[model samples]
Target: MTSQDRKDGIPAGGAGGEGARVPVTDGLRFAFGTLTVLPVRVTRWDRAAARAGMLCAPAAGLVVGLASAALGGLLLLAGATPLLAAVATVAVPAVLTRGLHLDGLADTADGLGSGRPAEEALRIMKRSDIGPFGVITLLLTLLAQVAAVSGLYGESWARGAVAVAVAAVAARLALTLTCRTGVPPARPDGLGAAVAGTVPVRSAVLAAVLVTALCAAAGGLFGISGSVRHTLAVLAALGAAQLLLRHCVRRFGGVTGDVFGALAETAATVALVVLSLG
Candidate 1:
């Protein structure tokens, strides 16, 4: 695979040149091709395509979230314990994305914890092996996810499933905001450069609003309190992701693929934790 392919699992392609009109299907292809290990082909690599892909990211997350919920629900129907169902819920996203986001999370953690200058820290993150920081962060993150999910499962199957779905969509929504205009790329080449600052600020905000509203509607199945909780969870997740994005920009000079991964995981964790609360 070329560097472009390595950026986000998008196969290197030359379709959709600059000034080419990007169709919605191309956008969907771009989103799934890069964000997940799905079999979609990415025929476009231009800024417009990237913008569309980022906007459609939440839709891709919805599919992933539903898949996660379905597996957990099935396991429960099979007489499995809540803990086992939670594990499956947490594992499905990682498996679907081929652990791309998780790997990025580890790399970002190692880079941030290196205590070195920006350039050196970026080099550290690029190394193949995981450092102590990466190992510890991954351990804590996964454990927290499983624990929170298990708690929700213990409450009720619907609660657990909804939480997983909400968390997944919120995670990708964070990515959309991260790529909004004004965020620069950390490197001249890579996924960051390809997608950084691609989205218009208004478009990104609109996507967030729409997603939050949909999530709130989904939560309405429970009650008024459920709607409020889901709305707050999304807001809190976005706030957390924004904070991380700002810090990473300051520390690394701008956004990177690893930073994107870190933001997604942070948002997901925060959303799940919030949903699991009373």
Candidate 2:
């Protein structure tokens, strides 16, 4: 059989952009495609799965939207209050990312709260336990988010879902923004260099646009806006995301995965709460 014929459906060679023969496996599936964490027993596949992996960063929002709707449906079925949906809209992300942002939040809080230099703040961020400042900061952020999301749930579900979707995509856009404009990898290579730096600006923009558009579609489909509140909500969340990311890039250099996670969660929460008001 020819080289192409000898291969299964998987691309035979020239997978990762060169003439090299990339491995094929489920791990490669996740890494290469929108499927996060590999399909199964496959992470080392040196092949490309753009149509899938490329979507992973943005698809996160779609997953979140469905997750929120699913959880909300479940709670509603159980005869619980819509307020319980707030848990799905808000808490699931923490569970999804395993509270990575809390780490960033702690790191940010500990860093800024310490009144130390930027380098020292980053160093403290690498610490394990939360300081008093971190503790207070986490509490306040959580309170603000919970209060906002819960309040929104009482009035509208569509806005809450849209918030989740928009915030999710915008957070990645912020990461892309930070990734493109910043110092190089702090170490030889970590997550930043491996993925962030390599992501082309247009690719990042496309991914971001795709996510943001999904949100706008949701809002438009549901007619979820009235008065000037909708515009303000979008502006506020996107604004918060931009300001925070810029601050971090200026202070800490490039963005970390922790920072990205925090950005998405915080922005989504803020949008939901703010927009729901009017």
Clashing pairs in 1: none
TM-score of 2: 0.73
| Model 1 Cα lDDT, one tens digit per residue, 1-278 | 23236454332256665345678898898888788887787778778888899999999999999999999999999999999999989999999887878888999999999999999999897788899999998999999899999999999999999989999999999999998999998988778888888888998999999999999999998999999999999999999999999999999999888888889999999999999898
> What's the true lDDT of residue 63 in model 1?
91
Best by lDDT: 1
Q: Which stretches of candidate 1 lie over 4 Å from their true place?
A: 1-4, 8-21
- Relative to the true structure, candidate 1 reaches a TM of 0.95
Per-candidate local distance difference test: 0.89, 0.53
